[model samples]
Target: MRLKPRQLEAFRHVMLTRGVTAASEAMNIAQPAVSRLIRDLESEVGMTLFTRQGGRLLPTPEAVLLLAEVERLYIGIDQVARAADDIRQHLNVVLRMASVTSLVRPFLHRAMMEVVGPRLDLPLVLDVENSRHIWDMVEQSHYDLGLVFGPPRQGDLQTVHLHSSTAVAAMPPDHPLAEKDVITPTDLLDCRVLTAGRNSPLRRGLDRAFSQAEQAPLNTLETSMLNCCHFAAAGMGVAIVDRITMRAADVKLCAKPFLPTIDVSYYAARPAGSRQILVLDQIVERIKELLDEDTVIAS
Candidate 1:
């Protein structure tokens, strides 16, 4: 039994759209043409792939199984298209990477430039996402590399430590604690505080510090680490953030050392692929160097 590309396309579209009419619209073809393709495909496969139900076409078990294989094929087709595009653009190499949003500007750019300088034609697809999503994206092979705060926990990833720094407290310029060179957890007593979300390593350390003081912050707002400075500048509360996030010199906010310091680790993570890209290695090396410089400056 031979299956034509149009027949498979129609079957895939109907399965995705769940109706001949919708599939026709999606594929920019007439409904009759779509139905004919599906019919031909079913005939070739010798199985009824869909059942008509109340104006909606539901996939039978065979159709569901077929669609899985079709989807895998589509993924390969997409990769081919991407490679063609890279060649068309005259890119020497293409590397897809992702990182937490906060690192996009101050961190990722610097690292990338350090490695790929003067080669602007080299294509780099960078996905900016939250730290929580970085691991899953890398593990799924959605991104070739990921730069993120904290250690890599997933078993599928090969991770390297890039930097380590202590947490710092950020407050509005005029906040009472701003006058202090180093503000400890107790110094924030009776004050509203902003911190990383509950699952964050930084938040865990902040919680421990407050617990040691036997005091709960008067109020707490949990948010992205990058937003901590924004919250502090807005006078929402004092924010606890990593040294990387705090290293920015902001006139609107004052950063001070946190007592009972919490250590934050940054890692360069990649899926354990059979082939490693040399560019990815260079990027990680640049990141390590930059972070080391930042540490020396802070000290």
Candidate 2:
């Protein structure tokens, strides 16, 4: 009863694709061949992997447990293949990075340009995702690193605090609140407020602030903090956003220090035990340098 790689691969594909026909196409094997592999795997493991129902393969309880282990195994194998490709030095080593949209444009882009040399054709695979998605990708080892706001939601991740900037109130220069040195929820009582979506950390904190002031965001418009700045600049509404995102946003707006000094933190999250490569380390350092610079515009 020797377990084979091909058997596990077939089992994995079948479970993933949910049918032998699709699994065969994915693995580039005939339908019967895929079926045979599954049968062999099932016999080797002594369990019913799947129960066929209406042309779909429904995994048994045992199969579900095995699939998790198989997926983890394949992730390691994929990492090994990538390492081998790096060793071969055929093309430039691909750096897979994922970050929230807030950091993608001016911050991460600039960091990569500064870190990756001009003559060196370092390949980059970047995904602009939400913080949660970026966290999952980096934790699952799908990405080399992830840039996210606040600490990671999941546990056992190594988080490097890149920068901490106080949140600011953004508005058009012509707006009346522009005269104020500091903007508060009370100041925004008459103005349309563009803010983070409800339940988000920023939103929750803002809600608390508004509660303390005995005020609410009237004429509320929900959007990301980056978009909040851009929209506010376009005269849509005043926005409350971190100085980092405000600085990064390519817009002309007045950024007054928001009241109560709400601080936002950015972090680079990676797998807990993963080893840092030289190229990634340099990119991370460059990002740190870029963030440390003050580029926020307050008109």
Candidate 3:
């Protein structure tokens, strides 16, 4: 004998509420109809599910086991219903992204404008961190997408090179070295230099350039953010940063090509073996296009 949907629903409600009256009230049906559905469910399963005691119904051991399975089935059905609702209303969908601080304002802003429109009504969860933190979060699967610079970490991650950018020396327009088309390590020797910390690849590359040039850079401040460019624009010191960091047209700073160029390659990374999401893939593509366009314009 086949069990009907009403029979299973009535049985589940009774098992949950442990009372026929409550089950009937919950299902918006008469108590007699609830009893008939429960009776039909028991007959279809060919087992006695409950026993009457003191004007109350007590579930038998078999009924308890059956109720566990019925709850699991209902949970699956509820999930399907929620998924359908989300599809209909475009709810509960968020794109989680992690990126280095420098990439957040310029790179991501341009990519979002190109891919998701400038208004960006879609739910986007963004985390700004250092390059190392971005890589670690993406590697651990805490972030759905990561934008970072330099070589990507190996193992358990899929990376695609977005583009490469060379380092630039940012200085106030009136700074003495700003007259030079390209700033050398020797040009930084006498100036108070704003630098990235030792953890940054650009810092290490610059250190090597200084070593090879046999000049000592007088580093006045060390920071990880692109704010160093703003400081340079404010005449604090000469700041060496990625070319992208100098792209803001309002900064009023001269970005000169740095000598012994440090080429930092940016990458779009995601956890390996994760299911491909269409939106994330499109975002990656848009970033690549924007970066390529910037490269062309710079050249």
Lowest summed-lDDT stretch of 10 residues in model 2?
290-299
Tens digits of per-residue lDDT for model 1 on 1-299?
Answer: 78898888899999887789988998899999998899888999999998988978889999999999999988999999997886665455667888876566566788877778888777778887776788788788778888887856858688989888788888877888888989776777777788888877788888888888865666888888778888788888888987677654243777788889899898988887635677788889887888888788868
Clashes of each: 0, 0, 0
What value does the lDDT take at residue 268 in candidate 1? 87
The pairs that clash in candidate 3 are none
Query: For each candidate, what TM-score against the reference?
Result: 0.64, 0.67, 0.72
What TM-score should be assigned to candidate 3? 0.72
Give candidate 1's whole-model lDDT. 0.81
Alpha carbon deviation, residue 63, candidate 2 (Å): 45
Which regions in candidate 2 have their CA more than 4 angstroms from the true location? 1-93, 119-121, 152-154, 295-299
- Model 1 TM-score is 0.64
User: Relative to the unseen true structure, what is the C-alpha lDDT of residue 273 in candidate 3, on a scale of 0 to 100?
Assistant: 80
List where candidate 1 sits over 4 angstroms from the true fold. 1-94, 118-121, 154-156, 248-251
List all candidate RMSDs to the true structure.
14.6, 15.1, 7.5
Model 3 spans with C-alpha error above 4 angstroms = 1-72, 81-91, 117-122, 248-250
Candidate 1, position 215, lDDT: 59
Over the stretch 1-299, how does candidate 2's per-residue lDDT look in tens digits?
A: 79999999999988887888888899999999999999999888899989978877899999999999999999999989988887565246677888877787787888887777584656778888777677878878898889988844668887888987777888988999999999988889898999987745677778778888876666889988888988999899999887677777878888788887676888998887977677778778888877776443332
Q: Model 3, 64: alpha-carbon shift in Å?
A: 16
- Angstrom error of the Cα, residue 201, model 2: value is 2.5
